[model samples]
Target: PDFKPLPKTNQSVGIDLGITDFAILSDGRKVDNQRFTTKMEQKLKREQRKLSRRYEQAKKDNRDVRECKNYQKQRMKVARLHERVAFQREDFLNKRSTELIRHYDPICIENLNAKGMLKNHKLAKAIRDVSWSMFIEKLMYKAKWYGRNIVKIDRFYPSSQLCYVCGHRDGKKSLEIREWTCPACHTPLDRDVNASRNILAEGLRLFETTQP
Candidate 1:
């Protein structure tokens, strides 16, 4: 299966991965992020609370928690919820990566510093829920299996801040500034769209450097 090379195509895509959506592709496509954790959080907390209460009750009764039926049953229920979330995320990533591999050549994405991003307490939960690192790993492994290429542009490339239409660095933008017009060309830009285009350009540049 790994031996079959992908069909030659003139397509190269840059993807901007984010918490709000799965990815923003350079080809004007947006894949919505599956917020699995957020969807299951309430249910998980309920199950966990039940398990905790059972543990506390067992302790109060001077009973061995291992020998307690309620404690054990609640524990298993909570465990299954966690497993469901994990499986759902994996399934989504696998399908998305496979589709991308089949279509695009030399996919480009940011070399994001997830660890550093997580340090922001306000955004930590959102960042953790998206699982960027895991998604990238899945995309990469599938790319190798199918004999495709992936490019990781430098983390500090400023994909969002720079104008894709005219090589102009407008300035740093806050997360809230989702849309802006380029000062140089007066070209209207959607933040993610411009970033995707820039990513595609960078990925293609990197690919050329590796070729004989």
Candidate 2:
């Protein structure tokens, strides 16, 4: 099947991806983190436990585990549960990416080192559950297919630490500080939204300079 390029739109957006919220847009819209893995964790654990019990029973009966019908059934149940979670995550990402590509001409986002971020034990699970890398991959491919542009700002760009209104460097801030007033411009800022706006501004600047 042929896929025609989508019509161009004047709208552009910057997205700040986070564990708390899936994405915060420069337009002040937030898409909630669905946390599909977390939601299915308890059910998956239960199925896995059942699978283990089936394996143990097979061992006790001197039955070949591979040929044990009960064990195989339980194993399939556990596998299906895992597949469900994966499918749910993929569906959410696809819908969101398609919507963004259709509506926005150029989508801006930060270049995050997802692998490096996973090194933090405290945040690793949440980060993996969100599947930021998968989401970005979807956005990239969709953008190309739909004639939309996707801009990734530098990882060290300090989108959060800088004030979007006045470009004042606020230095480092803990994640706990979700809102702050910019000293330079005295403007109140929402952390994710502020970062998104800055990303948009920086992305446009870079895009313009690179254009022929």
Candidate 3:
């Protein structure tokens, strides 16, 4: 199919990506994290255990594991479980990316260091399940296909730390601190929403400077 640019809209958005919520928009809308992998984890584990038992049974029977019909069948079941999870996650990412491109002219987001983030063992699994890198890739390609712009703010930007209302540079806040009142402006803020707004502001600023 020949791809055509979508009709332009005045709408622009900044997105903050997180594990709690898949994405938080500057407009205060949140896309809930589906946790596809986690949801399927138990079933997958059971199937894998069954596959292992089948393999062990094959070994005891003096049959090649690869040649054992029961082992192969169980292996395929485990493989299908993994495939289902991957497909679900990919479908979700594709839909969200396309929806954003269709509605927004210039989408802004923070340049996340996903690899560095995965270094935290406690967060690695959750982060992988969210598949931030894959989502960003989809957004980038879809933006190009749909004639939308993707603006990425610097990774080093203190988006979550700064107050979006008064631009006060508050010190680091832990992940548990989801909401706070701005010390400078006394305005209440949702951490993710505030970060998104900051990203939008910074992205637009950068976009303006880059324009001829």
Candidate 4:
């Protein structure tokens, strides 16, 4: 049998979490948005409607409803729909996270303030679907199991606003501005990538300065 030691590096990968871009790796790698929940929402809703209708009919029939085979069949159908959606979402996340773990040696990602973000009513559903917390939890343990490191940077760091090329800070680029040309370096920026790069650079600097 042959065994090999993992590579030791003085570098790390940073990631930015979002809905438009599922993940942006610090080294300018873009992982496409795999909106598993968003894609299944419509179908799930339709199934829920069918389930609700069955429940309503059962209610109307009262004591006699429990004996009906059709009601029992519809109940099982609805349960299967829910099971399918859960599997789809779990499968997508597992695949994406596994790919990242395989590609990067040391991964760093922002410690997301999930509760704070949920306060924004408009983003609530989208945030819930992205499941940032779950992703981080899985990634952290996987990295440990594979002899890789997962670093959680502070949430307050301005990954998106800082120019990765020139370190220029621009306060004007808000959440609405998805893509922008950097004012300092004249480089085109994909918002997520720019943020991810900044995160990676900052993490490297932090790792060096703190000797972590």
The best candidate by TM-score is 3
Stretches > 4 Å off in candidate 2: none
Could you give me the TM-score of model 2 versus the true structure? 0.96
Alpha carbon lDDT of residue 55, candidate 3? 81
Candidate 2 lDDT, 162-189, residue by residue in tens: 9999999999999999999999899999
Where does candidate 3 clash, by residue pair?
none
Model 1 alpha-carbon drift over 4 Å, by segment: 1-3
lDDT over C-alpha atoms for residue 168 of model 2: 98
lDDT of 4 by residue, 32-110 (tens): 7767667877887887787678778878878455676777777787788778767877887888887777777667789
Q: Residue 121 in model 4: shift from native, Å?
A: 2.0
Candidate 4, superposed: residue stretches over 4 Å from native: 1-11, 64-68, 210-212
For candidate 1, report its TM-score.
0.96
lDDT of 3 by residue, 1-212 (tens): 56799998999899999999999999999999999999999999899999989888888888898888888888888999999999999999999988898999689999999999999999999999999999999999988777789999999999999898899999899999999999889999999999999999998999888889
Clash pairs, candidate 1, are: 22-33
lDDT by residue (119-153, candidate 1, tens digit) is: 99998998888888998998888888778889999
Estimate the lDDT of model 1. 0.90
Shift in Å, residue 46, candidate 1: 1.1
List the pairs of residues colliding in candidate 2: none
How close is every model to the real structure, measured as TM-score? 0.96, 0.96, 0.97, 0.87
Rank order (by lDDT, best first): 3, 2, 1, 4
